[model samples]
Every structure is written in structure tokens, then in C-alpha cells.
Target: MPNQSQIFNRVVSDQEVWDFNVFADGIYLITIQAKAKNWRQNFKRLFSDDDLAVQVDDYLFTELSGKKREFKGPGTWNGNELKNSSKSVIILLPLKAGAHKLRFWVDEAPMLENISVEEMNPDIKEKLVLSLSHDASAIDFIYKNIEIENLEVKYNDNTHSQKSIETKTDTDTIMITIKRPQDKKVESVIVQFKSTIEMNYKIGRIKLYQDIILSSSVNLRSQPDDESKILESLADGEQINILEEVVIGKFIAGKSYVWHKVGAHGKIGYVLSSFVEIQGQEREKIIELIKFWAQKLNIESSYVLALAGCESRYKVYATGGPASDDRLGRGIFQLTNQLKIDLNDDSKPFYSPISDLFNANQNVAAGVSYFKWLNTTKYKKSTESFKKSVVAYNAGTGNVPVVGKLNLKNYEQQTQNLVSCVLENSQKKKWGNIWWPILLFVIGFFLAAHGFVTKLNYASAQNDITIDAISNFEPDRSIRISSATSSVDGMVYFLANTSFDCGAQNCHSVLFQLDTKSGQIRKIMDDVFGAAVDLFPSPDGRYLALVALVHGGVCNSGVYYDIIDIQSLTNLAISGYHSGRYTAEYVGDNKWQNNNAFSFSLTQVNCTGTQRGTRKGEYVYNMDEAKLLMRMEQFGPENNG
Candidate 1:
């Protein structure tokens, strides 16, 4: 028999192992020396353990051999010390030869000052030598024990100039240690590790067969168990991303109800699975589809989504009102029979079937198409126009107030609130607090710049007029006015066509001008047949600009503006200033810059085929020279005034 002695000094957490080779089998005595008071205090504080137990394991051959020996050293507590000189000993007899392993499992991380392995031969008086030492400046330990099934652990070591030791148990526990060099002093040791677990459910990854409509509102909790804290309250038909199903506790019906872990707007929570249908495409897929259709229709996807949230909350079979009223709204868009009248026209190639409203794809297609038509035709294809369309869809076309009206009803406010909610939710989903403010700033800057330029132009035009010209002049009579305005030189201009049959083939508009000093009112233009008309006066009162519709009807009519001299009451010969190919309609009021220059916007109204949407144009005219200063066929940010 050979006699040997070995010592090991290091810091360990949870579990650590050491392997060595022996020439012969003999009796051995193992002694473990550690700082009892400091180690025990730190261990108890970190691991919430009342007593720290050091477990030692001796294995013969491989770990799978099932031949193992276990030994427990003296337990240490906050106020207790070991029986012997801060050390414990375990004796082993008939130790096997060849490779052998020793394992130490501790309740918490502790500093091992020394460990001595002594091999004594009863026949020989000498002891054999085997010693190991580890010096670490800092050690960090992290342990995670989660009670979950089908668990998967992922470990990442990001320590700089340090070594890491990792150990995992079959019972879903992970232990990690970060060891730094002895010479280096770190302010603090950070052991970072992450683990993810996916619980297997009875059903594999499968497609939902129908739309999930909640029977009622339900609380979304942090955990599957009912005792978990409530994260949020989900309304009926709210879309959710279902991760997996679980059964945690007993239900109210004395049966186990399935619970689902779901994520929405960066929030993860659990909800009762029975509350949802578990059908239709995933929530993200539906959102993407809405975005795709909105882009194709040149509408804001957030607006469309907001409308869906208000109308049906993204439910496929959501219905509104009774069938007897013929006002039933169906599907995510909540489309009604009245809104689909254009589909019933036999002139069109395809018609939407009433039954198709229950289908998600068909319903979205029809709704987007109808909304596009409303924007292009029913409204003027502006932001305000989109708002008007939303109102009209909620109420009726007759209830839509004219532009400049302020007393909006409750439905309008509700629609606005819905739009805001959709935008907020969308921003949370996509931007995550980064890009939304930048986007809003850009939009606000453009609007401010446009307003500043408009005001500057107006002020410049007024600079050419004398104050006496405005104060001295007065209108001759109190004329019935539809829309009226006064020039800086004390001349009044008004539209006499207060109302007209806009749908008729021949609708007429009349323009009138009044001189304040002379008490004279005269007709500037009359019998301007078309859809709509507007009038503007030059600053010096020398010219009146008339923008009128001309031709057979609203759909086919062309729009033209004429600068007429007040002295001669005759149109000026401004070359290349007439509408070409497309009918132009005025947007807002025209601006007169001084005596010679003036600007106005026109939107093309008679475009066909793919160009059915309105194309805006801007024009500036030199009235004195009788020439066109500028003509932009397509006006936008690239060519803004």
C-alpha cells in the first residue's frame, strides 16, 4: 500500500468535482478546511438557508456504474462552528484503484481554504502525496430552480478575463460560477445567465379553424394559476398571440379549464382558453393583412385598424343591430348592405356576394374597396375627407356636416377616439418608443412651414394696399351671401349661387362684385354651369378671379379660372393657364399676392382607370403681364408653395 496526502483550495457554488488516479486500493482520510463563521453567514444570507450542509460523494469507476459512496461534513450555521479546527474529516476503507472522483455539493457558495486527501497504509507508516490548489480573486454563483416540464436551458457566458463553470440537473436546476483571476480586483461579480422553458401541450402547432370570439371580458394574468396577479383586462374579440396551453388549477365548474399564455403589444399574460374560439389566422397575420390592404388603397393602416377595432374588434362573424333593420354590419370591417350598393350594379364585372361578408378575406377586400371609393368620390381625398368617410360609415351621408361646421355629434368623437387608440397600439407594437416622436415632428414641421408661407404671402399682398382704401370703402347693400370676402381696397366679392342641384347635368353658379364708395353692385359672371364654383378678388380691387366648372356635368366637366378686369369687366388673356386634359377643382380659397401675382390650387377630377384618385396642381399667374408664372401638374412636398 502507498501513503499519500493532497490538499485543494478554491471557492465553489452548488456543486464541483475533482478526479484523480490511485495506484492501489487502501484506506484514506479526507479533511476539508474552510472559514466557518464568514462562510456560514454569507451562505445563509445568499441562499436563505438556516444551516449550510457540505455533501461529499465518492464514485468508483464511471458515474453510470451505480457504485457510489456519500459522506456529510459538520453543518455550519450563523452562530455555530465546527467541532474540530474549522475542518471536517471522512474516512474511507477498501478504496478502489484506478480512476476515482470526488464531488462536493454545498447549500451556497463558500470559500474552501484547504482540502487534504491522505492515503495511509496500515502496513507502512508513511503517507502518499496528492495536492490541488485554486486561487480566485472573485467568484460569482447563480442558481435557478424552476418547476416546469419539457424545460430547456440556455447559458451564455459574457465574463471578461474570467472562467465559467456550469452544471445542470435533470430536475430543471442550473448552477453557474464565474471565476476571475487572482491578481485582478473587480468591483462586483455579475453572473448573467438566462433559461427558457416551453411546456408541451396536448395539441401540437396547428392552424386555428375559426375566429376566437371571447364570450365576455376576461382578466389576463401573469401566470396560469388563478392566484397570479392580473396584468390586464381583455375585451371581447381582442386579438391575442397564443403561445401555449396549460392546466394549473381547478375551474369554477369543478373541471380543469385550459389556460393560454398570450402576447400582445409587447405584453405577455395568461387567459382562460375557453373564453376564446382558438380559430382563424394568428393575430399578427390578420394585422399584416390589414396593413397590406390599407397600403394598396392609399389609406393609413392605423386608421383602418382603428375602424376595425371600433366596428368589430377584428371578429370575423361580429354582427351589429337586428336583421329586420337591414343595418346589420358583419365581419372585421363591419360592412353593411347599404355600403355595398355599388357592388350590386350590373355594369360592374364582379359583385360581392352577401354570404362572402362572413369570410375574412372577402370581407376585407370588399371593405377596403368601398372605403377607397368613398375617399375618391364621396369626399375630396384629404385627411379631413377620410374623417368624413369614417363618420359617414358610422352615421349616414345626410348627417355629415359641411366643412367648417364645429358642432360634431357623439359618434364623431367616438370615431376619433378609436383612431387614436389604434395609432397608439400600432406605435407600441412597431416602434417601441423610438420612431413615433420623430415621425410626428416631421409632420408638424411641414404643417407649420405651410402655414407660415401662406400667412407671409397674405401679408405681402396686403402691403401693397393703403389703409385709407380699406377704411373709406363700404358695401352698397346687404346681399344674401353663400360665401363672401372683402379685398384690401374695400371691394366686396361674393358667390350668389347659395344652393344648386349638384347632381344635375346643368348646374349654374353666379359671381357678384360690389363697390363700397359708389354703392354699386354688379354681376361679374353668371350661368357658370357645373358642380361647384368659388370667387376671389385682387388686393387693389382691379381684378376678380372666378374658378368655375364648365361643360355638361360634374363627372365630365372641366374647371378653369379667369382673371377679369373690374374696369372693363372682361377676361384677361393669360396664355397656358387653362385646365388641360383633366377637370380641376379649387381646394380652399385662392391667395392674391399684391396686384400682379396670385396663386391657387386645383385637383384633377376627371381621371379614369388607374388614375381615378385626385391629382393636385398648383398655379401662379401674372395678371398684369397676362402670363402664367408657374404651372405644377402634380403638386406635393417636392413643389409646395
Candidate 2:
């Protein structure tokens, strides 16, 4: 059945060659020549078949049809005649009008010296006969040129003699059914299109759709080329702002790749475009909440935002339960149970329930309240008040070191870094300028007054005989003369040892206002006792401001201060004290600016022995009204009282 179809052949070696295409449906003949002498031995080892003498396997794949097919069968082998040592097999290729791939291999290596395909005549009735002899190397030839038509092939391997075939044809569609051995689950059909057609579908350029980050961390380079220097390594999910795209002048599988110049973690670098995806909107809600609270709190929104980021990274339901001693600190601002209790105490006019802290708004409100209080009281509106408040917010008022002490440097640096990052990303303005001159003046005045009081205290100690000077005085007597101050009118109102003991049935100290002119010492009232005693006489000397440790008895150990009327020897007003194992001291020399009003420093410690948190602030007390006029501000280091 030879016709005018072209006959292709070549002397191939141990290499792959891509050639030929099928444009019609017909039976085709394929020929292979093995040049190796021990081909049969290698074939048996490759397929793990000891008895296999002349088996050959062929594979074909195509891109357009996305299919793959494999064929395996026996071929002729001759050991005597080297020139006639070859294999021949018939393949029925049912293909559409397109290019197709053909590959031949023996023992897992290229063995076909040449491969040729020629169509058989459709009118031929008798099947082509082949001699099954070990030395038969000549393959029967067939040729026919006809109009393209759909076709299907059916073949059976010796392992499973079952055969089936299917075919379908449409104006633009072609289908072929392949029946594999029973042990094989399914078979792959391979089809290929012309190289020109495949080239038309290749990707040449990409457009920037949105910002993105790599699926995993990757090194960011200073240039788009692979040889460029690496500037930094970006983490997965780190945001990227794309500036431009670059395409490499190399093609991979008929497609080119792209690179992008992006800004990541404050650095600009180039990264592969394929590795990244558009940045997500997951943290948007958290950012919005931070902004809302920051605006409401009247602080720099960026600072608040940065604080929140540093604290809990904008996690609204974040809890310090497992991390804290009391299992407190809930919500974004991490409001503690102690703070909630203080806020809800009936003694305080500004009271709110602790449960309200679970709500993000309320938690932020509480945190902002404390922040504002710290800024206004402890830092005193200094230029670095926000930063100081941030530090205090983290370490608590008790943990903050005194001003000018560089403790907490690491914590300060960490907070500064977070603040700087937030500021870089945000457009919020810095806090208003502070009145530096006024603050400096106040500090200078306090320092000068402190020096003068220290000198005066030294003079008084040298002249006065203390109880410690007593010859057989017991240290645990729990009763000692604390201090003595002379009134403006020549009256001596001094604190002295009383019979009352803190651990005994009745325990308290008594204040005596002595009139030297009359040589009469009048007992005023039972007063508090502390480690140290302080007495502030009003400018008129009619009232005395006394700060001392309240004796521990039925009441817990604490520090207390009260305004006492010298004539009546009764406490007009008491403030700056709390129950528990605590202590208090005068912050600076008590000042009597006027007869009716006097100011003093009260440093208070909450938990005594362990030294938890302490508060030190200046307070103005109104003697006539028997009340505290105002809390001037917080100052000095904790436990410095």
C-alpha cells in the first residue's frame, strides 16, 4: 500500500531529537536501531525482567492537548549480524490536524538510530505481516496520502489481551480512547500544536495590580538583577509598596519572569514578582480602633498607636492572665484588676465597674486616664512627657526610676523604636511644646529649698538631745522621741514617746504643745508613729502638719499625715495614707505658704516589705476647711519619701 507520502529516516545515536507531526489519522510504522552490543542485558536490568529479550518502550507528550501516552512491546534482536540489529513496531496514531511529539527509548536510554512515519492506505484489506525472528531487522513500509479524518487505535499487550477503542469528530474537536493493560488504571493521550502556535500564547509582560509581600521570607536586593547586593531580608507578610516592575531578558518555557522594586520594612529593594501576593486588610480594624482612642485621649495618635502596638500588637482581646501574678490585665490596654478596684472604690468620686474593662473602649479609656494622669502629675508636662508616660505605662508608677537616672534604658529604647516606626508610617503631629522655663524654675526652687532645709535639720539635730542618746535605751521599746519644733510664739510642740505600744492593747503616739513661758506641757492627742516623723508648723503657728507612721494594731501598718490644731490638740484633717504593710515620707520640706493653706510632699508605699508600687506627690491642705485643697503633682523617685 505504498503511496506519495514522505519517508523519513536517519542514523540516530544516544540522544533525544524532536521532529515530525501528524496531520491525519492512519496506521504508521516506526523503526529503531540499537547500536549497543549488550542491549538485551541492559534492557532486562532497566525493566527488571530477566526473560525480556527484545522489549522496547516509547513515550509521547503534548502541550496543546495536555496528554501523555506510553507504548511497550517486543522487537527483533540479533547478536550475530550487527548491521541488521534493530526493532520495528506499528502504531495507530489517531490525531487531529496539529503537531504531535514522538520519543523512542530502549532500556531507559535513547536507542533509535532513526524514526520515520508513513501512512497506510485505507483501502487495504489485508493486514501487513511481520516475521517474528531474532535476526529480522527490516521493517515493512506503508504509505498513503488522504484527506484528514478522525481515527482511533486498539492494541493489546501480552499481559492483558483486552482491547477497546473510541472515536468522536466535530468541526473543531477531536477525541481518542486508549485501552491500557488491566493492571494499568488509566492512560494519558498526548497531543501537540505547532511551535508557532505555542509561542503566541507565551507570557511576555506583567502589570502591577496591588501591593504585596512574599509568601516566605526572601532576600531583598539593591537591583533587580540576581547579582545585585542584598540590602535586607524581608519577612513573610511584611508589607510592600510596589514602585515599578522589571522584566528579565530571558525566557523560561516560552515565558518571561518579572521583578519588582518595593519598599519593605522601611527599606527599598527589588524582589521576584512571582513570589508575592497583594497585601491583605487584616489589621485595618485594629489600626482604626487605635486611631479612635488616640484622638479621644488628646495625645498624639501615633504615640498611642505605637504604644498599643508595643503592648499587644493591636489585639483587642489580648490578656495578661497567665503572664501576670494576679491573673489580671485584660483587653487591649491591659487594665489590671487592682486598677479596676481603685476605679470602682466607693471612696473615690470617679468610680467605674471593673467589668467595664472588658470592653475595648472602656479599657482604652482607663489606660488613657492613667496615661494622662502620669503625664500631668509625674512628668509635669515635660517635653518628653509622652515618652515618660509610655515607660511608666509599661513598668508601672512604682517601677519607674527617678528622673536623671538612666535605668530602664533597654525598655526606653524599645519603646522609642516602636514610636519611631509608628511615626514614620503615620501623619500625626508631635505633642505641643512644653513650658520648659517654668518647669526648670520649679525644680531649681525645690533644690534650693531642699539644701536650706537640710542645713537647718543638721543644726537642729546637733543641738537637740534625742531618745537614742539615753543610756540603757532598748531598741525594741517601740517608743521614742521623734522630733521637736518650736512654734512662732515661743511654744515648743514636739513629738514624744507615749505609753501606747502598737502591738499592745492600746497603741498610738501623742503630740504635746509646750508653753515654755508658762512651763506647761499640754497633751494634744494620740498621733501616728512611723520610721521617721515630720512636723510642719503653719506660718501663724496655730496649726501643725504632722506626717508619721500609723502604728499597727487593729489597723494595718501605714503612713498618715494630718493637720492638727495646737490649742485643741485634735486632727483637723487627715490625708495621704492607705492600709496594708506600707510606709510614707515627706517628699521635701513642708511649705506653709500662708496661715490657712500649706503644701507638703507625701510619698506613699503600698506593699511594705516587698516594695511593690509607690506614689509620691505634692498636696495642698486647707487647714480651716479640714480637707485637701489639691494634689499639686507627682515628683521624685519611688520609695524616696
Q: Which candidate is the best by TM-score?
A: 1
Q: Candidate 2, which segments miss by more than 4 Å at Cα?
A: 1-479, 498-507, 527-532, 550-557, 576-588, 606-612, 633-641
lDDT of 1 by residue, 1-641 (tens): 34344554455553355555667655454544453334335454652322223322211111111111111222221123331123332222333456554554343334556555556443532222222133322222212222111212122232343334344332122223233334443333222222432221111112121112102356678876656898887776565655553444323221123456776546887765435434323344445556655665567666666566545545454555433446667666877777667555656432444445555655776676666565556766445776677666666666765454423334543344333344444434441111111111112111111110101011121132111111111332111123233343545554433232232243344455544334344556554344335556677777777765555444555555667787787766334544444444445447887888878766655444443445576778876566776566664332232
What is the C-alpha local distance difference test score of each model? 0.44, 0.42
**Candidate 2: pairs in clash:** 12-113, 68-188, 509-527, 529-549, 530-549
Model 1 lDDT at residue 310? 47
lDDT per residue for candidate 2 within 1-641, as digits (tens), equals: 24222233442321133455655645444433343234344454343211101211112111111011112223322222222234443343323323444433222332344444455443444333322222223321111111122222222222322222222221111212232333432211212222221111111112211111101356678876546799987665554555553433211110113466776667877765534432211234345545544554555556665555444434344454342245455555667777888766757533434455545445665665565567666776466665567666766666565365434334543344333333333343432111110111111111111110101111121132222222222454434333334354756555544331232224445565545344444556554443325678887778888765545543244555667776676675465434243443324547787998887666555554545566666767776676776465443344443
TM-score of each: 0.26, 0.22
* Model 1 misplaced regions, further than 4 Å: 1-277, 322-326, 346-354, 381-383, 401-407, 410-641
